[model samples]
Target: GLKGPENWGMIEELASVLGAATACSKPVSDIGWRPHSEHVGQTGKPVAANLYIAVGISGAIQHIAGINSSKVKVVINNDPEAPFFKVADYGIVGDAFDVVPRLIEKLKEFKANNA
Candidate 1:
């Protein structure tokens, strides 16, 4: 959400970078760029990914209800007290715009090293 139209393209790019399947909050699916099958929210599909990275998404109890079973829950939010942090295995208190780019860079590094 932080990025402009051009950078929004990066969200798709990042999906490949992370080897992550794209999932979204309800609003994004309502607009229809992604399928409802990939939606993660109380009224949508539940995710059981090995890693769940939530950014800018506030942890409404409803959202938490969907993803609590993830093996590793990592939350990135500027607000330190966001409820998602309460259930997250790792929490990053920072702007997601900055953090996500750095995280993508680091993940690329991680993949390179592991490969």
Candidate 2:
């Protein structure tokens, strides 16, 4: 589970760089780490994005239900048994701290090269 608000900065940065919107789990919003408007779950907002990347969020039934409409789902988590893997199009089992920064750097490099 996420320790604090500091962990979200990288996630927000990645989302910004990817031109993707950032959303959090119900627990994160409830803990005041994110606004309710940014929460995604059956009890929160529903997601229908073409690409959805979930970081450090274990899939709850409610959360999965909301994002089920997304065309593609990618999950990044340390837990190999996270339920999110069941529905994800791709899964990266690793520490978000270690993975996200590298992913952002690679995406930035790819964008620059492709541009």
Candidate 3:
């Protein structure tokens, strides 16, 4: 999967940090940058994640259907009413670019302390 090379390091770190695999939405995967296996959608691969975090995604009905079964759904988008919030167990209505980094930092800090 090649959504972007920028996040692979972080993904690798976090996967180890949380014991999770990396996945992306069809819209991002369709760009040919990401592998088909990375697609998560009603028409694509179905997922039942323990913690599904959607950042910068609009969370369309089609997309949500695939992820709705997750034990925890967290959405971060600038739009106050991105519609994803309705299905999310927790949501942050803000710029994902800003929120994601902060979240990563916090998680890293917590991981460091816990370790």
Candidate 4:
């Protein structure tokens, strides 16, 4: 599940900037933190996106199964040994709270410079 809904604003902003659709693990949707429509997993909606960015998700087998079709997978979690890292094309080990803000800033900077 995600760290908390408080940081979802920045997460959504970043996804918007990247033109990416947001999805979440089943638990997130089950807990009513995110809409079930946004849930992606074996029992949820299937994702075949070009890129999947998973944040704060522990990457259960069911969760990973849904996203296996993605061309690229990026995982950001505080746990270095998270199962998600095993399958991620790129893995960042850190707190999403600390990392997401910096990532949003960098993405904004890149967009400003490129635009």
Candidate 5:
């Protein structure tokens, strides 16, 4: 779970580098893993970012409803059958531990080269 302190720093770093807002699923918020202010779903905050990336989320109907307005949706989940993939413009079926670090590296490289 992303509630782990070890993973939280990486998530925050990635979001900071991407200049993106961070949000959490209802379950995460309800469980007190994340603050309710960051919750994104039918019962929480709505998201309409140009690019929405869902990592490790199962994409419940309420979650989908909140993020459906995003111009592009990217889903990364280890489960190939995760519902998030059905609505995603790009899908990566892999462990977040393996995928996120590589993604962060690539994004950093891109930023460095483009900057």
Candidate 6:
């Protein structure tokens, strides 16, 4: 529900800075916010990344099944009771709008310090 079309740019930026591939829930693709090729879930593409970060996904069973092979899973959502948390190595309970920007800032800071 939090996958605002307006936020796509920031999301793409997040993926770029993280050196991560971008994928989305079935609904996001179904609604045409993203291409079907970018959809990942039981009914879509399966992912086996070393690290997977799911933002704003509510963790439907199908979605979890597809990403289960990921070595590490992190979930960000506003709902503390979101099912994704059950399988996540780390979970952040907050609005994506607020949490994502802060996360990006922190990552950039860490990158600068380590560089």
Off by over 4 Å in 3: 1-16
Give the alpha-carbon lDDT of every model.
0.79, 0.93, 0.77, 0.89, 0.87, 0.91
The residue-level lDDT of candidate 2 at 62 comes to 98
Better of 3 and 5 by TM-score: 5
* TM-score top scorer: 2
Residue-level lDDT tens digits of model 5 in 1-115: 3646457676777788899978989998887777999999999988999999898898999999999999999998999999999999999999888888899999999999999
Instruction: Give the lDDT ranking, best first.
Output: 2, 6, 4, 5, 1, 3
| Superposed model 1: Cα runs more than 4 Å off | 1-7, 31-34
Which of candidates 2 and 3 reaches a greater TM-score?
2
Best by lDDT: 2
TM-scores of all predicted structures: 0.83, 0.97, 0.84, 0.94, 0.94, 0.96
lDDT of 3 at 56: 64
Looking at model 5, residue 92 earns an lDDT score of 97
TM value for model 6: 0.96
Clashes of 6: 0
Clash pairs for candidate 1: none
lDDT of 6 by residue, 10-60 (tens): 788888889988999999999989999999999999999999999999999
Candidate 2 residues 2-37, lDDT tens each?
579988889888999899989999999998999999
CA lDDT, candidate 5, residue 18: 94
lDDT of model 1, residue 85: 88
Query: Which of candidates 3 and 6 is the stronger one according to lDDT?
Result: 6
lDDT of 6: 0.91
